[model samples]
Target chain A: MASTMLRTSALRSTIRATPTVASKRARLAGVSFVRGKATLPDLPYDYGALEPAINGKIMELHHSKHHNTYVTSYNQAIEKLQEAQQAQDIAGQIALKPLINFHGGGHINHTLFWENLAPKNQGGGEPPSGSLSKAIDGSFGSLDAMKQKFNTALAGIQGSGWAWLVQDTQTGSISIKTYANQDPVVGQFRPILGIDAWEHAYYLQYQNRKAEYFSAVWDVVNWKAAEKRFK
Target chain B: MACNLTPLISPQALEPHISAQIMTLHHTKHHQTYITNLNAALGKLSTAVSTSDITTQVALQPAIRFNAGGHINHSLFWLNLSPPSSPDAKSSAAPQLTSAINKKWGDMETFKSAFNTQLLGIQGSGWGWLVKEEGKNDLRIMTTKDQDPVVEAGLVPVFGVDMWEHAYYLQYNNVKADYVKEIWSVINWKVAEERFLGAQKNAFGMLKASM
Candidate 1:
C-alpha cells in the first residue's frame, strides 16, 4: 500500500513539475539583471597611466575595443536567455551558458585587471604592508620569490590567459593560478591580483617578448589594491 | 571512479606556435576544473544511484554528462595533440593511419577542411571529433554538444578538438579560423594511429564475443 501510494504521488509530482517549470521560466524571462544592464567599467586611471610598462595605445585598444565588446555581448546574451526562458525554450537556455561564461567572464576579468595596476608614482611598485605582508612572506617565502614564481607562471602561458594571485575565501589560503583567456579565478578563490597575458596587452610594445613584458609589469603593479583584496 | 586532471604540455615545449599562456591556462585551469567537477558530481551520483533516487539522478544528469565527457574528451585531446607535424607526428610517420584517413576522406587536406568547417559551425561550447565506430574500418566525423564524449555514441574518438572560444580566443582572437588552421601544426598523429590500432582490437573482440 505504501509503495503504491509513493508511486501515485511520484507520478503526480512528475506531472506537476511541467507547469511549475514553465511558470518558473516565465518568471525568469521577465527578470532583469539586479544591477540593470552591464556597462563598461571606467578604468580607475587613464590609459596612459601605466606608461612604458603597458603603453597607452595597448591600454586604449584593450579598454575601448575588447572590454566594451564583452559588455555589449553580455547584455545581448542575457536578454536572449531571458526571452528563451519565458518561451520555455530549454535548449536555448542550455545553449546560453557558454555565452554567459565567456562574455560575463570577459567583463569581470577586465574590470579587475584595470584596477590592479597604477602609475609607478602612485605606489604601483610598492610591496604589500601589514597583514598582507606577513601572509605573503609566510605563504611564498618572500615577496621577491613570489614575484619570480608569479612571473614564471605568467611567462609560460601557452595561449591567451591570465596568471592570478588569489586568496581562498574559506581557508584563507593563497595560491598562484593561471586561467585561460578571460575566465576569472572562479569558485572559492578571491582574486587578489591578475596579470593579463593576452597578446593585445603587450603586443604593441613587447611584441613576441612576453618575458620583457612580465618583467616591466612589476613597475606598475598596484600592491595597495592587492593588499585590500588580501584582507 | 574519479577522473584526474592530466599533466600539461609545458609552455616552453609548445613555444613559437601555441603561446605558453594559452597552453598552460587551457590545460592547468580549464581542463583541471572539468576533472575536479566531474569527480565531485560523480560522488553525489554514487549516493543517488545506491538509493535509487530517480529524482536526484535526473537532476544530476547534466552535471554528470558534461563533466564526465569533459574529462574523457580532454584526456584524449591532450594526447592527440603535440607540436604539429613534428618528427613524431609527421604525416608520413603513420602509414596505416594515413591510408585509413585517405580511404575515408579521400586525402588529408579534404579531411581537415571538412573537420574545421564542422567544428566552426558548432553554435557554442562543443567538440568536433573524428571517430572510428565500433567494428567499422571507415571513420566518421561527428560533433558532440558540450562535453558529450564520443564514446557514449558507440564510437572511439581518434582526433578531437575543443571549439570553446578559450581554445583560440587568446591567440586568434575573433578569427577562429586561424586558430583552427594553426592547430594542425601541433597535432600528434602518432597517438591517433595507436588509438586506431588499439580500438580495432576492442571492436573486433566485441564482435567476436557477441557472435
Candidate 2:
C-alpha cells in the first residue's frame, strides 16, 4: 500500500495581458517579408561583461549557440512560409505556427534582451530616470516595488520561458508578464524589460538556484536603454 | 482534481548517469506546471462537464488531455526509477518484472530494443509505455504522442518514459538516443511488478462483474 499511493499552485498575477492577434500577424508578416535574411545581432558588450552575475560561458553559448540557432531557424521558417504563400500551400503555412512562435520568439526576445542589459560601469543596476521613472512610480508604486513584482513573475515561471515588463504603447501603462517556451510578446505592448528564465540562460552558472540568477540580473538592468524606448 | 504530481523518488537516488539537477527541475518545474495547468483545466471542465456544454468541452479537450496525461504519466514515471542496485550497475534490478518482460518480448535485451525503438520513433514530444491489456496476460509496448494518457486509450500503463524534450534535454541535449539507451538502468521493477499484479486483479474483477 505504501508503494500503491503517492500524491502532489494556484498562481495569480496582476498584469493585464491584452494579446492582439492582428498585431501578432503584423509582426509575423514583417519577418516573413524579409525572407531568409534574419541574422543574429551582436551582443551590446563582451561575453564576460556581466561577470559574477551572468557568466561568460553562458553568454557565449546562449548568444552563439542558442540565440543563433533561433535566428537561423526563424530565417528558414520564414523562407518556407514565403514558398508556401507563393504555392498557396495553406496546410504548410498552418504547420509553421509552432516553429514561428518558438524560433520567432527566440530571435525577437534575445534581440531585446541584449539591449536590455548593460555593463555595470555604464548603466547596469541603475534605475530609470526622467519620464520613465515617473511612469514606474505611477504604475507600480516605486522602482524597487516594480523589480520585486518582476522577480515574482520570473520565479513563478513553471518552465523555460521569460518574465517581461511590457508597456501598452497606446496608454503607456506598465504590465508584468510571462510567456512559456520561446513565445515572444508582440503587438500592442512595447517590451520594457525582459528576464530570460530558460534553464540555458543560467543553468551553466546557477544550476537549480534560479532565485540567485534572478537577483544577480537586477545588477545588469539597462535602465537607460529601457528609458529610450519609454520616451 | 483527480490528477497530482508524484513525490520525487529523489534526484540522486536515480543517478550517476542522470544528474540531481535534471531530476529536480523535471519534477518541480516541468511536472509541477503540468499538475497546476491540469487543475486549472479541470476547474473549467467542472463547469463544462456539468452543463454538458459540448462546445466548451471540445475547446478544452486538448488542455485537459495534455495536462491530465502529463500528470498521470509523470506520476507513474516517478515510481518507474530507483537507484542502481549493483556496484558497477551494468544492469537493472527487475528479476520478477524481467520475467514478465521476457515472456512478452522473449528477453530483457530484446524488450529494451523494442521499447527504445518505439521511443526513438516519437517525432516530437511524447511518452513511451509498457502497458497490460485487461483480462489477459497481454503486455504491449506503445507510444503516446504529446502528453497523451494511456488510460484514454483503454490500457493499463505499467511503466512509462517521458520523451518530451524537457525530460532529457538538459542532460542529453539533442542526442536523445543516449538517453533511451541509458534509461533502462534506473527502471524500478518493483513498482512495475506491483502494478502488474494490481492489473490482473482489476481485470479479473471486471470479468466476474460481467459473469
Candidate 3:
C-alpha cells in the first residue's frame, strides 16, 4: 500500500505542469491530506550523498531506522493524544506531551537535516550567497568565524544535543546555541544551521572523537538551505 | 475569599463583568469539587497498592496528577481573572511580567496573540500553556488535556489557561472557545513572570526530581 502511494506520487512528479485538473486539485491539497497524515518522505538523494563525511551506514541507520522510529512514535502519540483529548482526560493528555515532543521533534529535525545535506562533491560545500552571506558576516565577523564558532560549540556538547546556528527573532541577528536532547529552539530563535550531536549521529564513524565528526560535517554542510533560512 | 485562598480579585473589583455572587460560587463550589475529587482519590490508595508494582504506580499516576493539576490550574485562574479593568488599570505602569514577555515574545500583545491562538486550538477539555522550554529559556505553547502538569512535557509552564468545561461552563455554556478568547483580558502578567523565573531557577532540579 505504501509503495503504491509512492509510485503514484512519483508518477505525479513526472507529469508535472500538464497534470489533470482533478489530480492537480488533489495535489494542491496534498494527497495525504485525505488520510490526515503523510508517510515519511523518501530521501531526495541516495544514502551515499554524504559519503565519507557521513558514512552510508550512518545515513542508512539515521534515515531508515532512527527517523522511522520517530515517525512511528509521533503517529502513535498523536492517536493517543486525540483519544485523551476526546475523553477530557487532561491527565492523560498531559502524560502524552513528552512523547509528542520527543517524537515530533525527531520527525521535524531529521526531515530538515535530510534536506540540508548533499553529496560532498555536489552543491554542498561552497559559501552562502546574497543576504545570507552578508548576515553571517554582519553577525559573526566572517564565514570562517561562524563555522569555527558553530563547530566549537557543537563539539563542546556535554551529552546528547544539537548545536544550531539560529536567527534571533528580536535582533534579526544570527546566533549559535545548543539544545539538550530533541528540544527544538522554539520561539526565541529560528534555526538556520543545525548539527546533530547525538552519539547515534556519529558514534559509529568517529567513535569517542566527536571533534573529528564535527570537522567532517563541514564538508557537506548544506549552505543553500541555511541561506534560504536567512532570507 | 470563600475558600480562604488569597484572591487578587475583590468582590467590588469583579462587579461589572462577573457578579460577586458568581465569583463566590465559582471559588467556593466549582473549584472545591476538583480539590475534593483529588483528595478522595489520594485517600483511597492502599499501602500495598502504593508499593506493590511500578506499572501500577505509573497507571495510577494520572488520578493524582490530574486532580492536583485541576486544583492548581483553577487556583491560578481565579487569581488571574478580574472584571474588565477600567482604563486606569489597563494603562497602569508596565509590570515586570510585561518586561519578561517583551524579552521572550517581543511585546505583551504578541504574546497574547500567540497564547490565544494556542488556546483556541485546544479541541476539548485541556489547557493552553505558555511555558519556558527547560534550559533554553524560550517561550513555547503547549496544550495539556485533563490534568497533565506543564513540566511533565519537559517545559516549565509559566502560565496556563484552563479550558475545561467546569472552568467556564456556567458563564459560557457550550462556547468554550469564546471563553478562551475572552479570558486574555484578565491575564495577570505579573504573576506569570514570577512563575517563569521560579521555574527557570528550579528546572534542572525538577528534571532530576522526575528521576
Candidate 4:
C-alpha cells in the first residue's frame, strides 16, 4: 500500500513538472502554484496487526479520520499562507502559524509513531542490542527503567500530547520528554521513540484505564526503529 | 493550601449520559491530578515571589494557568451537572436563564442547537461555553482552547461544556455529536440560572471555600 501511494505521488510530480504555456499563463495571472500537498503515509502493517495491545478499530479511525484531517488541514493552511504572502497580509500569515504548527506537527509525529510500532511476529518488543542498548543502560540504567519513566511521563500529560524518548544531538544522551497538543520534537533533540498519549489514541480500546494502554503498548514497540534513530 | 473539592453530585449520578466509570476517573484521577499539580505550582510560585526570581516566576505561569484552570473548570463542571432524572436537569428549573436564552436565541431549543454547534466546532482539547457578557444580561456562545478558563474581564462563564476527548470518549467514542446531544439532559440549568443572575463572584464559591 505504501509503495502504491509513492508511485501515485511520483506520477503526480511528473505531471506537475511538465510545465506548459498554460502553467506559465496561470503563474503570470498571480495564481498560487501548488508546491506540494502533504499526503497521509500508508501504515507499515495492516490495521489489525497491532491487535490486543491496540485494537484495529482504533487504528483505523486514528489514521484514516484523525491523521487524514491533519494532513488535509495542513495543506489548506499552506495554500492560504501562499495567498497571504502574495497579498502581503502580515497579520493573516501570523494567524495561520498556529494552524500550520499544529497540523504539520501532527503529520510529523504520527508518521514517526506509526514507524515505531510492529506486530509481535515482526520482532516488535525485541530488546535493543549494541550501541542503542548500551546508551539505554548508560542513561536510564536498564530498558525497563526507561519504559517506566516514559510511561510516567505519558501519564502526566494533562491534555492531548506525546511522550518521546529523545537523544540530545550534542551529547547523544537519551531522556524522556513530553509535548502538549501536536507540538513536534525539534531543535537539538533527536526523537528516538514517541508514544502518543492523546485520548483518541487509546480511548476506544482502553477508555479511562489509560495506564493499561500505556503498559500494553510496550509489547509492540519497534526497538529496531528506535535503534536506527539512536545512531 | 491543598484543594479538597468534592463533587456536588455523586460520581454514579450522571450515569447513562456520562458513565460512572468515566465520572469516577474524570473526577478522581484527572481532576485530582490537576489539583495536586496546582498546589505544587502555587508552592513554587510563592517561593519564587518571595525571592524575586522573575525568570522562575515567569516560567511557572503556564503550569499555574493550566492546572489552576483545570481545577476551576472541573470544580464548576461538577456543580453544573446533575443526574438526568433530577428536577435540576429541567430547563424550567432555571426560569430566568431560560427567559434570557429566549431573548438571545429566540427559544430554548435554538439556544441548545447553537451551543451544540459551538461544542462540535472545537478542535483538539478545549471547552465550549454559554457566557454572559459582564455587567449585562446579554449571553453569547464561546470556546476556550486547552485549559484556558474564561477570564476575560466582565465576561462570565455561566456554564461550559468540556470538549476534551477524556470527557466523552469512553462512552461516546468518536461520535462526539452523540455526547453533545446527551449532555443537555444532565446540564444543571438551576446552577446556570444562579450564575447568570449572581455573576462571577458566585461562580467560584467552591474555590473560595478551599481558601
Query: Each candidate: what lDDT?
Result: 0.74, 0.74, 0.65, 0.85
Q: For candidate 3, what is the DockQ-based docking class?
A: incorrect
The runs of at least 3 residues in candidate 1 whose Cα sits more than 4 Å from the true structure, single-residue gaps closed, are: A1-35, B1-211
Docking class of 4: acceptable
Give per-residue CA lDDT, model 3, range A1-231, as digits (tens): 355335434532321222355355556866432223323657766787788899887787778877787777777787677667768899999999877887777776776676566565656777788988998898899999988998988865533568888888888888889876677777978888888987567755665456888888988887876776674
lDDT at B51, model 4 = 100
Give the alpha carbon lDDT tens digit for every residue of B23-104 in model 3.
6655665456556666665555444276775565566566667666666666656644545664322413235556666887
Off by over 4 Å in 4: A1-32, A170-173, B1-21, B32-69, B82-123, B138-142, B148-155, B207-211
Residue B119 error for model 1, in Å? 7.4
What are the root-mean-square deviations of the candidates from the true structure over C-alphas? Answer: 16.1, 12.7, 22.4, 5.4
Q: How far is candidate 1 from the true structure (C-alpha RMSD, Å)?
A: 16.1
How much does each candidate deviate at the interface, measured as C-alpha RMSD after superposition?
8.5, 5.2, 20.0, 2.2
Instruction: Give residue B151's lDDT in candidate 1 (0 to 100).
Output: 65
TM-scores for every candidate against the unseen true structure: 0.52, 0.63, 0.46, 0.77
DockQ (C-alpha based) per candidate is: 0.03, 0.13, 0.01, 0.43
Which pairs of residues clash in candidate 4, taking residues 3 or more apart in a chain or in different chains? none
**Model 2 B-chain TM:** 0.84
Q: Could you tell which candidate, 3 or 4, scores higher by TM-score?
A: 4
The sequence of per-residue lDDT tens digits that candidate 1 reaches over residues A63-125 is 888788777888788879877987899999999988878778877787777767878877788
lDDT of 4 by residue, B117-196 (tens): 88976757899988987679899999998898987777878888899998988788777899999999999989998899
